[model samples]
Target: MGRHVFLRIVDVVSNFDPYFQQRFDAVRRKGLSHLQKCTAAMCMLAYGISADDVDDYVRIGESTAVEALKKFVSNINTLFEGEYLRKPNENDVQRLLQMGEARDFPGMMGSIDCMHWQWKNCPKAWKGMFMSGHKGVATIILEAVASSDLWI
Candidate 1:
């Protein structure tokens, strides 16, 4: 992600949840900044890394990183769901259809894509079914549709 976009997300999420705000420890020293917490959360989500792995670079504790990830996802959903995570309306569908027609892909309103998401806690029985041949890890396939604007 670009710096500005990442910062914008941090700004929005921090404003939505005080948990992202910097605080003071018992010694009156400043605690982790919003960027650190958010970066830790983002690293885990984007890179499919474990919370323990986040500490190596983001300098966050495993438990705290888990908490930050939970809060970050929850707040982002609560704050932006209505605007960015909703199903498209009639107007949106029409616009996308027209755009697709212009590009010679009639009736295609958006593009669909899939990615393998690591399933860290897969059950033993299910691991065989979920395992990815190339990655050699248990995973779940996540599918998404996005318009030209990259809204998923």
Candidate 2:
């Protein structure tokens, strides 16, 4: 992610939960920054790194990193789900329709596409069902509908 995007996410998370906001520890003389905690969690989840491995760069204990990840996910679900992951409403549909009409595809507001995503966490037994031997990778296919501004 770009610096701006990362900071924006951090900003949202910090606002949602004070735990993700950087803090000073006057008593212990040290405190972990939210960036450290969040970076550690992102590395673990995005790269499949072990919790202990996150300590090398972030200097966060495994338990603390895990806790941060848990809290981060919980707070994201609480704060952003309403806006990013919502079913399209009537007003949204009307806008989509207008865009489609301009393109000469009246009454067609959205299109569907099927995509295959690598399933990094696919179970062993389920691999046979989802894996494509030709691609030599385990993948799950999903069909999604997208309009100009939203994915549903």
TM-score: which candidate is best?
1
Candidate 1 lowest-lDDT run of ten:
143-152
TM match of model 2 to true structure? 0.78
- For each of the candidates, the C-alpha root-mean-square deviation to the true structure, in angstroms, is 2.9, 2.8
Q: Any runs in candidate 1 off by more than 4 Å, and if so which?
A: 114-137, 146-152
User: In candidate 1, what are the lDDT values of residues 66-126, reduced to their tens digit?
Assistant: 9999999998899888888788889988999998899899999889999998888677999
Would you list the C-alpha lDDT of every candidate in the order shown? 0.91, 0.81
Taking all chains together, each candidate's TM-score versus the true structure is: 0.79, 0.78
Specify the poorest-scoring 10-residue window by lDDT in model 2.
Answer: 21-30
Deviation from native of the Cα of residue 93 in model 2, angstroms: 1.7
lDDT of 2 by residue, 83-151 (tens): 775777898889889988988999998888998878787789998998876478898788788876665
